[model samples]
Target chain A: MSCRPHWISPRWMISALSLCLLVLAVTALMLGPAALSVRQVCQACCHAVRGQAEYDPVTRIVLTTRLPRILLAMTVGAGLAMSGLAAQTLLRNSLASPYVIGVSNGAAVGAVAAMFLVGKWIPFGAVPVLSAASGLMVTATVFLFAQRGRNFGHSLLLTGIAISAFCSALTAGALYLAGERLQTLVFWLMGGLWQATWSDVLIMLPLMSICLIGMLLLAPAMNVALAGQRSARDLGVNVRRLQSLLLFFLAVTTAVAVSRTGVIGFVGLIVPHLLRLTIGADHRGLVPASALGGALLLLTADTIARTAAAPVEIPVGILTALVGAPTFLWMLQYRAGGRAGV
Target chain B: MILRAEGVRFGYHIDQPVLRGITLELCPGRVTALLGPNGCGKSTLLRCLNTSLRPQGGRILLDDRDVMAMAPREIARHIAVVPQDTPTDVPFTVRQMIMLGRYAHWDTWGQEIADDRCVIQRCLERMDITSLAGRLFSELSGGERQRVILARALAQQGTVLLLDEPTSHLDIAHQLEFYRMVRELATEGQAVLMVCHDIFVAPMFVDVAILMVDGNLLSCGSADKVLSEQNIAAAYGVRAQISRTGEASFQAQFK
Candidate 1:
């Protein structure tokens, strides 16, 4: 029920986040490694549809490569961030992340097995879809294992940690044995936008869309879940089923992003935490805002990585880790100080 | 109006029973204070009433319909609860906080109907929290937050309101204010069941008191009849001095 003036409620925060996301998206599309003016970008985008011979190669690059990259960055970042947000809420731990708590690690193991282990049975890239499928499988396994009893937190986090350790060890062993292909494998682990193309974006779009809509549908449930399991169940939430469903959705989103981005850490960890400071902990606000914030952060980081040294590109993941870790530390300090005062 | 529990038994595991064979009917339009020391099945029994905790051996009925047979949302439509230490980790505005009570009635997409909005506004007004509506829930003082939670339960507009120790920690003024609000709700024919620790305050405020001991309902009747020295000592293991404060009113003090 509406208890206050409509003007003073959460609608304003939602609209505010929406406006920020739009501005960030436009900025991302207009500015990048190739550098296109807004007018030029628009004209190029407009004329390219009809096979016009008017726009330059730079324009084509923006239309065909960078725009899709930006969309993928936003959607994937959003998915990962929302997953992280849901995980944090579900586990009741501010430090929880799809990656840090092992969901991404599990996915990585799955993907790596698909690449290295599955390759023993098939030709190289013969099962091109193996890594993604494997990632989903691992994520599902981790989710199921984490949701057995009342100790959802310990079960999920501990299982994730174990899975991550196992995956990391296997990945290390695979890298050690690969020899000549180690460079390519290392780059995949470091994470970059070098592989981003229209096809990759097409592959990711449907899954990302489904995950985003699913998170939005569960926004209220996430809100209730934040009140803790007992209270949430009392409030008519089927806590066990809702938790499992959330875990499945989170893992799928995490696995997809990991399969593409190779475990970009802070998009999941930092983005949602940052949004929580301004928007509070309402998942309805946090999920969408985290998506927008993650996309904007990653795209901007990627754009800077490409242009900072102009010919030698820095990996996008490293740049975010550089920025994100300190911000996370500051939040920890702020919260600690707040608690001290109390 | 009729709250019935027939042969109720519960346990986390099958072999161990936390509650065994509890049969009682809670009468309507009265304030029933459930009293016992910790882990005496006070919370367990309350949870069963709303199907938050499933009954292992028996059934709970609300208006002749089995409680477990009804959907959780349907039960929520009739029974609103204020749980212990409801945390506000997020800074939802007071209005947003109270509107969560309307969640059961909300659509799948969480759309707020006009009637829902009206009920929220009325509850906020009733709780005298109209001024606090714009404040972040996390920013409120503990007493203020408690009132907002009470307002949220009121917004559910349930005839049976269940509160677990609604005023466990409060200043004297705030504690008295909470019961005053509870009395008002009861006057409107809502069945108010509250778990209380302050033996003196509950009997003073409630019409009926349910004293429980070792997961058993030891006595249930009007506060004056049920909260005698013998019953209070049996349930709480405390020596008490009972004094008549007014006609049909008594206060208890420790020796």
Candidate 2:
């Protein structure tokens, strides 16, 4: 579809998205199970910053529980969206996502196995490392196998689907065998931020920061690459190297996010696609915009999951899919209508 | 710079060659039309010359240096290719698409500088697509998209421009406009080699015509000398009538 002349520029779009994210982040911290007011949240934040112990339950809940969860959601959301942007560009398929390419499932399998074998002994920190390794291996295998022909995008997607199915089956079998740990395994697989701590944020912040910066720095090459492999080559892009590097980073971002949050779907797919439609597909704008848009989306979704049922929290992943699937369908319909010259 | 392909050989399979011992030289300020029947090696040879496809046997030299030794970006600084079909799935605006041509000149992070923007503007004006600068590339008509692609190639500022069947999707008027742009580019000191299927239309715009059949060059000369009835029959397996319409134009009627 043609781009309508909206008064908003790319810079304006980024600023707006960042503002939305800020508002959403503050709201998420303020409204949770304990339901602290804005003043209490701000006061708690200030006291925590100044290293004072007020010893109030409201401040404790606000600083210790809600703040880490909010930060984790923001970081995971940004990481997934950036990964999805890279995946879509690298595969040249808008349908591609971190979950679609089997990396999330691979990480899920690794995280599940780590949960059974090492989650008790090595604690929560070791799961992401193990999952990142496994996810990287799976992504590399898919790349090697599907890189044979001219239509690599289609082939890569197909290979990823196959691997994803296999990984999902393995994860299911692990869940079945988990027995007493079934609730924990199922909770992780459905995706929740309940286990998030400052330690998890420590692991997520640096990894997501590196991957996000890498995606932005490589945005120009990725822009040229949208012209397809042959044109990208003629335009001076080393297509193979660019694809490899982008895919590597995509796997890393997806792996780290999934291992920490446990198989959150649709954030990676929906955020980039939605941002591309609204702002056009210039990766220079798309990457950062997707980052902000993604943080806003997941923050909003996780807040709803935390507050919608109140005493009972629905998994964030279910809410995202429920929202993302219909939006994705509408996107497909719009694209089809556009192609029909309507 | 002079682009010379010497004894180049290539094939999809080992035993069957698509291009066999092909040799040609393209000089600046000349427009050369490559004409051949379907399944001939015209497009293959063009790809080899541009370093998109590597020849197993010979060397392609640009200004007496081997192009294979150069990095892809280095080669791209001297050669630009307008592919048969441009990707429409990406939602890049026309101006942004044209700016992508400056990729070779960009530094490590590949940010577009002020000069790159100026070049993009110049190319857009040169191609007469300034009015469509804000339009999405996917939303443009076939002709507008083709011109935008040409503008991108011009923005590359390469000495050699290679086009593969550029008019396959254009109407007759757009095709004429396309070739006129090519002629203008060549006159401004770029070597233009285009694979064209229209025998009658190509002779009107190009300075030289190269005919290929069965992976061999059958004729390489002025259009009047190369599009003779005998050469057409031998290369295309058809009877043809050739008539000189003007000083630099000829009509070929195949029967």
Candidate 3:
């Protein structure tokens, strides 16, 4: 075993990573087309003194546009991270994620269908509500399939995969039907924070906060549930009730994330697994750590998406895939080499 | 905590009953070993008692209270169970695993109260595994895992415990150790019901023995009365010689 010390304790690592993320988020807000110095940003934020006295147009842009985008990144990151942690522990599989269970695809299908059918009638904020409803409907369908027998993980995963495939086919059909007016919609599917507004932040903040708090409250029960269904029952846990509550929470959180930032694959899958290696599957630590680490990673990715090509701002989703795929490959190699030592 | 099952009839389908009109009572503060051949419904009966597998027709009374009417968690508060062959895929520390036994005592949030920790400590102490508390259950040997599981039951602080084939994988020393722990728990005023196939050791382990053949109660009484040569032969369909090992100890050999 490698004798690497100091980074082993999860609390220290989480705190260090969270502090670094706060700094990175501030840097993201400060850097844009019209660059504002850190001091200038602080002064502009403070300059909301009586009757809008001499406010910079760049400062207004920072407050309205970039701030909401940063908050969107944080909320989606935290929500996806916590959802991934819950799915992995509940299924007792290292590779389990909200997307692996088809939640993202389900939300995407709902959004695409709603765009095709009801986009003219509904506003932008209403699209997320429709997408969330669709995702939850799919989750309910999968949950019913899971309860028919004793094989919990096997049944749940199989049902999730089946639902994912069905949703993906629907999404593809919608994309094909939307031939000419599909440019912005297709870009949305790839996922970006280009249109993030105060209303979006207003909605996502409370939803993600509630999910995070609820998941933390249920952390102890989730720990018991992770010991497998029968063992959990023998220990006096109501295994069936636990499963229902978890599925509901996971579906809602994942739906919220997908609604905010189209189908951002692999964030949920990778963040929780990396945290598990250090924290050892105790949800008490894993939940909070994954949330922070996820926020940091996406904030950094969004920053690079903005600054990497100054003249042409890249879609944040494309940047995430570009960065995440290589990191995922390296993680796979590390796991194969036994460097993780799990 | 006496367990009484009256006129129990269970079947997967109505056409073929697994347990047919079986009536039995488990005495308080005693270890009762359940003996039966394969496919004879020993595990089914145990499950019925624990309310894991509800009998299609019967009234199971724990301390004369109808088990069917009580909530499962309410029943869990009074009865702890160790199923045969619990699958372990995830690695958990013995402390973390045993802490789950306090679930009935916790609120919806599953808080570990000071009393819960105290009960867990005493359980680990009783099982002589305080040192192994930090060890991962998957990392432990089979014998160690069994003892930790029993400690989890002990932590429930229930009046009755139902175990299914608890010592099947244990060597002779660990087998005796397991039985000794069960006997000690019974002496602490908890009723213990264990299903075991070691007919030879069953006589020495429990105060009473219940013999089952083809889902019917063949015999139920004191160990000496129920472990008779005729009863053994009748239940197993084999000839046997009953020999005395000590002044009060007896063993049966197949002929």
lDDT of each: 0.76, 0.86, 0.79
Best by TM-score: 2
RMSD of each: 3.9, 2.7, 3.2
Per-residue lDDT of candidate 3, residues B131-213 (tens digit): 88876665677898888888888777788899999999899999988888888888888888899898877568798889998
lDDT of 2 by residue, A1-342 (tens): 455433246788999998888888888888876777889888888888887746767778877888889989999999899989988888888877877778988888888888887745787668778887888888888888889856777778889999989999999899889999999888888988878899888888888888878888888899999988889989988888888888888888888788878888899888998787767778888888998888888888899998999989999999999988898789768766654221
Give the winner by DockQ: 1 or 2.
2
Clashing pairs in model 2, backbone N/Cα/C closer than 3 A: none
Candidates sorted on TM-score, descending: 2, 3, 1
Off by over 4 Å in 2: A1-7, A53-59, A118-125, A176-178, A326-342, B253-255
The TM-scores of all predictions, comma-separated, are 0.88, 0.93, 0.90
What is the C-alpha local distance difference test score of candidate 1?
A: 0.76
Model 3 alpha-carbon drift over 4 Å, by segment: A1-14, A47-55, A118-126, A176-178, A181-186, A318-322, A325-342
Please list the residue runs of candidate 1 whose C-alpha ends up more than 4 Å from where it truly belongs after superposition: A1-40, A51-64, A117-120, A123-128, A176-178, A326-342, B238-245, B251-255
Residues A85-148 of candidate 3: C-alpha lDDT, one tens digit per residue:
8788778787888777778888888888777666578775677778888888888888888778
